[model samples]
Target: MQICGGGRYDNLIGLFSEDKGKDVQNKNVPAVGFAYGFDRVIEALKMQNLSPEFENRKILITFVSDEFKDYCVKVVKELRERNITADLDITDRKVRKAMEYANNKYKYVIIVGKKEVEENKVTLRDMESGEQKFLGVEEIKFE
Candidate 1:
């Protein structure tokens, strides 16, 4: 979410030779500059109504027990660091409710529990296909 633009401005210094009504000076030089405005891009995204089919893949990390909360957060962080869109369930909700939310809003869900954490693995579920599989962090894949 950034835009940068710059161009050469030859003979532009003469225009600024007189500053604050001070004594005018005779000089000239080329100038170039660039600026990035993320706020404007964010505003445009909010205003635009894109098709649902164009949405990016979303992953939800759900915990099987409170004991694995830290591990769940770590997994989410790792995914995000890899530029993967991921979220975590921190509301202390039941598995059924969490799965429902993930199925509705996320494309995939990674179930983290004691066993998975102990084995340094996670249960990856494909929401659309209702298919599930166990995979190590290094074995994880995305669409």
Candidate 2:
């Protein structure tokens, strides 16, 4: 795929200037221009088996109550700061439905409920293995 093309164009800028052949007030400007075929680049990467593996690092967060929205948001913010892809689910869906959604898209699921809030911990579930473990808020590390 021809992903991109660029080359020097000394008169390119000059052609766009108010003066017919002068890029600046009294002089021509040497310039270069480039364009990328983003779709073609993505196709090439897919063909080369180089596409991003988002599921490997993506996580879904599910909280039990609306009261814990702030806490969940804080956790999500911290995870993002660490370069971890985290998503907080505050929808009205049941926990089971949320887990199902996570299983389809994320590698891990963080579940926080009243017990977890009181204990300052979260239940982490491995979506692929169906395993769950408890970890402190500060102890969770994905990166």
Candidate 3:
């Protein structure tokens, strides 16, 4: 029941072997690699009750259009700088679809639309309480 395996490979070594760029063949440097059976390991963890709990501190930023992409990215960067787990939805999905995707995974959702862009504000929605408010990007507070 090996959940993971690793050792060494001697033939795999080079500066750029795929020849995509310059194939500068270097000496065989000692390297080791390992891989895990991710699905099996997760199942074992669940059975043993060793899986970690969700933190629920992550927030999702969804935009109405590409027009607000820059603003949304800036907001995300600010949140990350403050040590908050923030992610931007770049899938070009509709606002409703984005909300559905963030439904159970994120604690809050920051919606950036035309109004928010023009006003330098965002609509922050609490997923748990179903409460929302329009706030300036700098005014968004996190727990």
Model 1's alpha-carbon lDDT is 0.77
What digit string (tens of lDDT, one per residue) describes model 1 on residues 1-143? 34556778876777767562554344556678777666665455666754233234578888878999999888888887876778898998877899997767788888988889989999989899989999986677654
Report the poorest 10 consecutive residues by lDDT, candidate 1.
48-57
Local accuracy by lDDT, each model: 0.77, 0.81, 0.83
> Residue pairs in steric clash, candidate 1?
none
lDDT of 3 at 115: 95
lDDT tens readout by residue for model 3, 35-137: 9998778677767777543245588999999989999999999888876779999997999999999888898999999999888889999988989999986
Selected candidate, larger lDDT, 1 vs 2: 2
For model 1, the stretches where C-alpha displacement exceeds 4 angstroms are: 1-56
Pull out the clashing pairs in model 3: none
TM-score per candidate, chains pooled: 0.62, 0.63, 0.68
lDDT of 3 at 112: 93
Cα lDDT tens digits for candidate 2, 7-42 = 998866656777774436444677788999888887
Give the number of the best model, judged by lDDT.
3
